[model samples]
Target: ANNPIWLIRNGELQSFGPDKQPIGTHGGEQNPFTLHEMQLEKGDCLYLFTDGYADQFGGSKGKKFKYKQLQELLLSVHKQSADEQRRRLDETIENWKGGLEQIDDILIIGIRIL
Candidate 1:
């Protein structure tokens, strides 16, 4: 992806002991995307997502959907229209989470090159 890497964390919300690592410390990489210098010709799209969207648990007793499932969902909808892709992604997350509470804030963005 050519888009900038965005990081989000909430230390106040995380529950961690003094000796243990913080919950959100591993949110993202320290550096932004290295492709910032690249220029897009046209008709390029980049999508970035956070784990919150895929880590959600639901179903009968609740279970984490995991990253593989999220990647598959993205690949399946990769060729669809941008709007449709977003809609499908949202729907998939909602369906997977069911009534479970969201564990963390989710951030996803789609950028279209012009």
Candidate 2:
């Protein structure tokens, strides 16, 4: 499965990076990993995260949290202090999870360009 990497740059939330094809040492001719390059402006925020966050089963219908919703959530809180942003993200996901055990590890990094 080709999952996209989410990113936020200069107040714009977007997703890019990583090819959908699986990587293996065995018998299939697979696409090589793409080399992505980007420039960061002062105060820009960049995020690198695992699929677990978006794939979480939660919300009103116990559906996946989703990339779009995640994007919106981050956008709304991007202007807050870095620590505050992290806290909010954690709190939001935890509430959404509603005490369910997540199958995968949740790892998200938010970098603010200076």
Candidate 3:
């Protein structure tokens, strides 16, 4: 599976580094993780997150949140301050999850280029 890191700059969202799986002992053989290098300018927002956010099941139809929708959600909030972005993301997912039990661990790291 390709795991992508999300980037937002000038109100546009870009995908990068469909990197390998998570670093863990579950793999059959030990493999080095891929290295991704990118130059970021001021105002650029970068997000690294686990699949839990997208894999969560919710909404009216009780469907997975999906990556596309996550991308859009991040794009919509990337310009906000880090605290605000965190709040919005948390609120959005909570609202989306509703009363469903969380199925996986969720982790998201956001960095704003300075």
Ranking by lDDT: 3, 2, 1
Candidate 1 ranges beyond 4 A from true positions: 1-44
Best by lDDT: 3
Candidate 3: clashing residue pairs, number: 0
Q: What tens digits encode model 2's per-residue C-alpha lDDT throughout 18-70?
A: 67676556577866688778766787777777788899987767888987888
| Model 1: per-residue Cα lDDT at residue 84 | 97
Candidate 1 lDDT over residue span 1-114, tens digit each = 322232212211111112223334466554432323334435454556556776688756698877667656655665578789889988887887888888886777756565
Model 2 scores a TM of: 0.81
For model 3, residues 1-114, the per-residue Cα lDDT tens digits are 257778888999888876465565574765677777888999998888888999999998999999999998988888888889889999999999999989999988998998
* 72 Cα displacement, candidate 1 (Å): 0.6
lDDT for each candidate structure: 0.58, 0.79, 0.86
| Candidate 3 RMSD to the correct structure | 1.7
Clashing pairs in 1: none
Clash tally, candidates in order: 0, 1, 0
